[model samples]
Target: MALLHRAELRPTKLELLAAWLPGRAWFGGEAGADLERVAAYRFDDPAGEVGIETLLVRAGAGPIHQVPLTYRGAPLDGAEPWLVGTCEHSVLGRRWVYDACGDPVYAAALASAILADTGQAEEYFEVDGRREGRAPSMAITVEGAHRADVPQIRSIDRVEDGDPVRIVTESVELAVVRRVGAHTDLPGSRLAGTWANQPTPLPLAYASLR
Candidate 1:
């Protein structure tokens, strides 16, 4: 389960994305277009140190976009290039945000989801020491079977951020689709999801063992 705080964020998630998205090569919307949050889903980090969330957003009259992000208390070493920017959390103070494609924890989680069928995490609102169940804004399905062992991804071998953000490791290769609704028939296990305004499940990411 993932615990969520009701604290405020300085430069809300959309604000940060607005300033960063245009710079990405795969971003197809206007540079100054307003982005709307369609929906989101989270993946639990087994260690419980990092927060992994994927946001589905869209600009005016543009295609929905998929952006996977990771939140950390401190800067990720050697990840300066992938840094989206920093935001201050009311409850957690300073947060180091990065593109999930650069986070090993995200890579491991994605691989596990594809190869081991571990779906999205269950979320709860922590209020006054009590946990309240919170329904996920988005739902996902994994096209794979349950597995006992998944390769441990401690570091990333390469990251190629394009239309499909490619994360490569010694044991696996993952392609994170940047634009929603643009599904392709790719080999290997895949992860698909659906949200508001989108009823059909669309490919979000694909992974293959190396």
Candidate 2:
């Protein structure tokens, strides 16, 4: 289960994304344009040490973007380049947010979900001392999914259109699809599917990164 809190965050998520998104090579929108978080999804951290989330944001009237992120209590070693920014969470104190591509926890969790054919994690929120259920943002399906140990991906080699982000690691070529289109699927994709609202079997993620 993934639990949420109704607390404040310094330099809110949208604020950080506003300043960070335009600078990315994959982002085609202007940094100054208004961006809205239209949808989001989460994955469970079995150890309960990290927070994994994927956001669907729209800038102005342009295309939607998929940004997977990981939140930690401290800096991620060797992943300084992926840091989105730091924020102070009222409930969790200070947190270091990074693009999920470089965070091992996120990478593993995502791979596990895809290969296991698991959907997005169920969500709940803390209300007073009670846990209340909430609707999930989207549903995912991974075709040809098979059980396996979560793959380890250290970092991203590069980002490109029509290809999964390759891992920089040497042993395995694990790749994940980026810049998804909600209406279509990718060829050569090990895992293929879509969000709940998408009208077709959109290519949400891929299994390997290499």
Candidate 3:
């Protein structure tokens, strides 16, 4: 289960993405265009240290882009290049945010979800000293068979950022689609989702054992 805090963020997630998305090679819209949040989903961290969330945002009339992010209390070592930026969480204090594709914890979770058929995490938010169930923003389907185990990912070996961000670990190779519905033919165990105006599921990411 993923706990949600009803706290304010200094630079909101959309604000951070607005400033950061245009620089990516896969971003197809203008920097000044308004970005509207389409949907989002979360993946649980078994150790419960990092926050993993993937957001779908549409810029103006352009395509919806998929951005998987990891929120950490401290900076992820050797991930300076993938850092989206920092934000002050009213409840969690300063947070170091990075692209999820560069996070080993995210890689492990994503690979396990794809290879083992584990779906998105359950969500709950705190309100008035009580825990309340929060509905998921999107629904994900995994196109892979159940597996006994997935290899542990201790570090990210390589990251090739493009239309699809390729994260290579010792035991798995993950391809995270930067633009939803753009790269559907990536050969691997797949993860697809649908939400709101998008009824048909679209490819979000895929993984293959290395």
Residue-pair clashes per prediction, in order, are 0, 6, 0
Which portions of model 3 miss their true places by more than 4 Å? none
Which portions of model 2 show Cα errors greater than 4 Å? 148-163, 168-172, 182-197
| TM-score (all chains, Cα) for each model | 0.96, 0.84, 0.97
**For residues 1-210, what per-residue lDDT tens digits would candidate 3 score against the true structure?**
899998999899999999999888789975578988999999999999999999999898888999999999999998998899999999999999999888999999999889898889899987888889998889999886668688888888899989898999999999999889988888998999999878998999999998
Candidate 3: Cα lDDT at 140: 95
Give the candidates in order of lDDT, highest first: 3, 1, 2
RMSD of each: 1.1, 3.1, 1.1
The lDDT leader among the candidates is 3
Over 37-82, each residue of candidate 1 has an lDDT whose tens digit, in order, gives 9999999999999999999998887888999999999999999998
- Model 2: weakest 10-residue lDDT segment is 182-191
Model 1: per-residue Cα lDDT at residue 137: 89
Model 3 is weakest, by summed lDDT over 10 consecutive residues, at: 143-152
Q: Judge candidate 3 at residue 131 and give its lDDT.
A: 86
How big is the RMSD of model 3?
Answer: 1.1
lDDT of candidate model 3 versus the reference: 0.91
Compared with the true structure, model 1 gives a TM-score of: 0.96
